[model samples]
Target chain A: MCQLLGMNCATPTDINFSFRGFSQRAGITSDHSDGFGIAFFEDKACRLFVDNQSAVESPIADFIRDYPIKSRNVIAHIRKATQGKINLENSHPFVRELWGRQWIFAHNGDLHQFNPTLTGRFQPVGDTDSELAFCYLLDQLAQRFRQGHPTLQQIFDVLKEIAPKIAEHGTFNFFLSNGQALFSYATTKLHWIVREYPFKHARLIDLDMDIDFSTVTTSEDRVAVITTEPLTNNEIWQAFAPGEMILFKDGKILQQVLTTVQRLEMEKKDPSLVRKTKADPD
Target chain B: MCQLLGMNCATPTDINFSFRGFSQRAGITSDHSDGFGIAFFEDKACRLFVDNQSAVESPIADFIRDYPIKSRNVIAHIRKATQGKINLENSHPFVRELWGRQWIFAHNGDLHQFNPTLTGRFQPVGDTDSELAFCYLLDQLAQRFRQGHPTLQQIFDVLKEIAPKIAEHGTFNFFLSNGQALFSYATTKLHWIVREYPFKHARLIDLDMDIDFSTVTTSEDRVAVITTEPLTNNEIWQAFAPGEMILFKDGKILQQVLTTVQRLEMEKKDPSLVRKTKADPD
Candidate 1:
């Protein structure tokens, strides 16, 4: 499996501090040292970086520990060997362009027996179930709204419909953005938080680092962070129920829906619950 | 290179909207078709995923779009081959057990020439600059403050001292987290923002989607989002100086420093501003 870190904000900021501690686990603190990658959104585009090396030990990673960049959204990843070879081509936080806008994405999970016949509108550059799903999703989106571009709500509705079908194959957890709002979903483990004014202090569980939020933000500033797990021991991180979907914009959630619209269906077909019973063999 | 997306918040939130637009670029919209990965923080740990496939077409990515795993801190990525082969051993959001905690990391950018001596305190499992640097950084941290544990501020200070030394070698920008606060830095390009209270409506530039944040958050929620670039077009994304370091906790900037304090002196002596000019390679 891999790790994910993301930020969605109302005002422009930088991600230097969080990236520092997160990169350490790539090779220094833990055993995820596979490959690492990150993307920084500027305006409508993004600056992307990737390396086929353990982030903790990468020279580029070292440089990033001190370099500072401020943006409204950012996504990052560090890898562990699973379902693919350790190489640059397989690094995460992929990017693409649609409707003249650049989009970025990352995932941390597996799918079993998920063989979808793609029409080749979007093809995978690497061999992983994650990519196949991404393409399939785009294919669906293109097909569903081919008459014309649909509204955000329209796309959201379709995503809700398609998510479970893909999850039937295996674990699916991911993040997506396009110089706009952030989208994330998890059939298994996923969590998130929003930070605003009157903020308090936070401490990292992996490294000894603390900060006072009151000092750096205005009453107008708000941020939303999502991750696979909690990054701190001091903070109370919330867990997502089995089969849930969420949308974020301006550092706040815009929509949330249960995996199944009906409660009875959730009890028997919730992969999130199954994740707790085991089955993360990637 | 790979792309990254991040979010930090005061209260728990989810990323579903931005991720949808972002993932489109992985293989469907644009072309970061190598692989993808992401992590979500809960309390002191995270669940991570990685795929050696383009996010735009990955089934895992699709599931991520539909599944909603709420998290406070989230990191994600999409990959394009830059170093190493296309394999899972090199996927990111690398994780490590450090100081009895799991640390997650992801990196972007490249290093031209960087090979440092390692004391074997940390080792690299793959042959990429990222792993080497990740290990070296841990070795330095372990050697510097191995006695019990240091404070988060102390850790940031230590990184402040070490970051620029590595940046001199090449472009380094990254995101790091330890299930606590997020640490970010950049030598060339990175950006960030904060959001709170009175959240407004926002739309994705890549995909046709708009989200009204007022409906999803309470008055108590605040968040900070950071990235290598701006994820939304309507929001303002702040750029980092040539060398800057910052700490993010509870969705706000806690500490700001200039890692390359000597950049002025170096610039004075250097005949060419090669470093600055080369940063924007596009």
Candidate 2:
């Protein structure tokens, strides 16, 4: 199992505050520490940093924690290596260029027997199921829209249809971004929070650190943070349903779909559905 | 014009010494400092770091100089921004995936009226003549070899056919790598050096620093460095011919091609044919 973190902002915003707490899971707070990677998009292009070393010990991660890079979209992952060997190629978040735009993807959950046929447009360089899934998703997008770039709504519609099919294999929690928006889907565990105007002081749950957002942010600044676990304790974090997908843009939920309504109804009927909480080990 | 730096090694070797001097040209020694980028390849994948800030002041560049990220194939660029805006997208050392292998490219010269038709298979995210050339080159390769990966020899042959056509538009000195080998083409200015066993002390021209390579490297280590200008004063650097292309692998020149032998014959006949030297401004 791995950990995922994503941020979409109304304006360019830095992820240092959230990443400091989130990266602690790599080795300090928990042991999801085979490798780690992060991508910060500057419009249609991004700066991708990856390392096979644990985030807690990597000098690159140390630089990231100290440097404040402002980006409207950011995706990060801490890997524990369920399938692939521990190397730089296997580190997430993975990136590919599609339709002249760079797309970034990171997976947190394991998939069983998830191989899919690819048409050679997008291929995985590393031998990881997560990267294979990412390539498949991009291939599907390219196949669907063979001409010009697809609209965000069109992409969202396609993802809403594809997420459940891939989730059927096993857990399929992922964060994907194309510099314009962030699409997050979860089959088991995920949580998100939106911080907008009238931001309050928040304390991190994983580390003994706190930040007063009001002091650092303008009223126009809005940010949406999605993660496997909530980073802060004071803020209200909303957990996704068993099978839910959400699209975030400009620091707000642009669209959302419940792929597994039948599962939710079954949970409603049966109380022993076994929903994982924040205190549960991932 | 921009500046280029590349390294191809028989073993994984760090570029700290060369990079320290090359980065000084960003703002300290010379002013090719609109932005800078570098790609370090590990197998078929690479870690690409780019910054809009000058390499002299960018924190990421500072970290790269301090931390030794060893790689067999590394391509770096310091941009002067003749064609595109000074931003992360237009920064050189552009990367794209073709045939499941990551291709890294960096251009050092400007191309005028060099718009080539793209088949929508590979597109440029940034608006630059250099990126457009890269996209066009990849599109040609993908079209030429549609089924599977092409051998390095085939790719080099295709490049030999394509480089001169692009150089016809204007100056087109560039460095390209696909993890397996490095292909360098020179239209105006480029230099290279290969260091093997019995290495001696080398002194940097840009900075007051020296390194005793014999003490730090093993006998098995062989490194080939390509740059816009010679970095060391003591080492013998060979300048590329006006239209020369070289393929380097395992720290040695695997193949060399003179695309414009007619021009070389003319230059030999006419002693007045001007050539840029080490002291000439790029």
Candidate 3:
């Protein structure tokens, strides 16, 4: 299995504090040493850094830890090579250009038989199941919206419909963003926390590091951090129920839904009993 | 006008030494300091680092200068912002995926009123004339070859035909690569030098730095360096003629051509006197 980390902020924020703790899982705290990658979204632009080397050893990762790249949306992953070979192409936090904007995706779970037909438009440059899934998702989006980019809610509606089809293959926990909003879906393990105005001092679980949020952030600043495991021990990390999908924008939950997995389970018992409302309605 | 630098090698080679001198042109040496970007290709995979910040001032450039990320093909650019704003999206060394490979492009010159009709498949995320030209080229390629990727020679043939149409708009010196080969076309200033088995010492023109290539390279290694201007003072850099196109692979020139600019000029003088052969035929 791999590890995933994502951040969405009300203001442009740096991930050095969170990344330092998350990167320890690459080789130091854990053995997910195959590869690692991270992407930071600054408005409509993005910066992606990927390496086949373990994050603990990669100088790029070290640079990232020290250099504060401010962004509103970020996604990161540490790979364990479940399906693809250990190479630069298979590194996570895969990115693609869609609707004249860069979209970043990172996956953390294994997909059993997830070979979906891909159109020529968005093909996977890397031979990884994660990349294939991302391509398929984009292909579907391109097909659904043949014209210009749709609204955020329109995208959410389509994703809610398609997320279940991919999840049917196997465990499909992922985070996706297009610099505007972040969408997270999980069939198994995933956790998220929102840090708001009265941000307190926080300590990391994997590293002996502490940061006083009050000293660094203003009252208007808000942040939402999603990870496979909580990076800090003091924060209230909420774990998702199976088949839960959440959309975040400006550090707040914009929308949430029970994906196909949960909906199907409910429908199998009683088709009419499945709830039409979202899982965690705003 | 901006500055362009490209490296094609028979073996995976680091660009730190050349980049040090090349980056100096971003601010210290000259003033193409609007932004800078570089893309390194490892097989079909590519790592692109771009910043709106000047190469002399960006921490990302500092990391690149120190970290030795080896690659077979590299394209770097320092922009003077002839046609676009100084922003991350408009940074050079733009990348797009096609035929299951990452295609990297960087342009050094300006294009006036160079807007080509774009298909929805490949569109420019950044509002730059250089990016628009790149998109148009890719769109034409995608249109010409509806199946899998064509051979390098086929691509060269198509590029030869289309390059002139874009170059007619304005100055369009560029470096393009899809990991397999590097293609350079010059409508204005571009130069190249190939360092082979009998490598010699070279001194940088922009900085007080020198490298003994004989000490760092093996007999099997060969490297072709292409840039806007010669980075080293002692190297035998061959400047490209106006409207000349060169294809490089395995650190050697595979093909060369006299683009439409030269052909059109020749035809205007004498209708039946245009040559079909390459400009610098060996």
- Per prediction, the TM-score for chain B is 0.88, 0.92, 0.92
For model 3, residues A133-247, the per-residue Cα lDDT tens digits are 8999999999999997999899899888888777765678999999999999988889999999898999999999999999999999999999999899888899988889999
Q: Cα miss at A61, model 1 (Å)? A: 2.1
Candidate 2 lDDT at A165 equals 76
What TM-score does each of the candidates earn? Answer: 0.48, 0.92, 0.93
Candidate 1 per-residue lDDT over residues B58-156, each given as its tens digit = 655665687676677887777777656655445666554345344666777665445667654344433456655666676687778756356779878
Better of 1 and 3 by DockQ: 3
CA lDDT, every prediction?
0.69, 0.87, 0.87
Each candidate's interface RMSD, rounded to one decimal? 17.8, 0.8, 0.8
Question: Which candidate leads the pack in lDDT?
Answer: 2
Clashing pairs in 3: none
RMSD of each: 23.5, 6.9, 7.2
Candidate 3 residue lDDT tens string, B225-272: 999999999989999998899999999999999886633342234423
Supply the global lDDT for candidate 1: 0.69
Q: Which segments of candidate 2 are over 4 A away from where they belong?
A: A261-282, B261-282
Question: Tens-digit lDDT track for model 2 on B245-279?
Answer: 99999999999999962222332333332322211
Steric clashes per prediction: 229, 0, 0
Model 1 achieves a DockQ score of 0.02
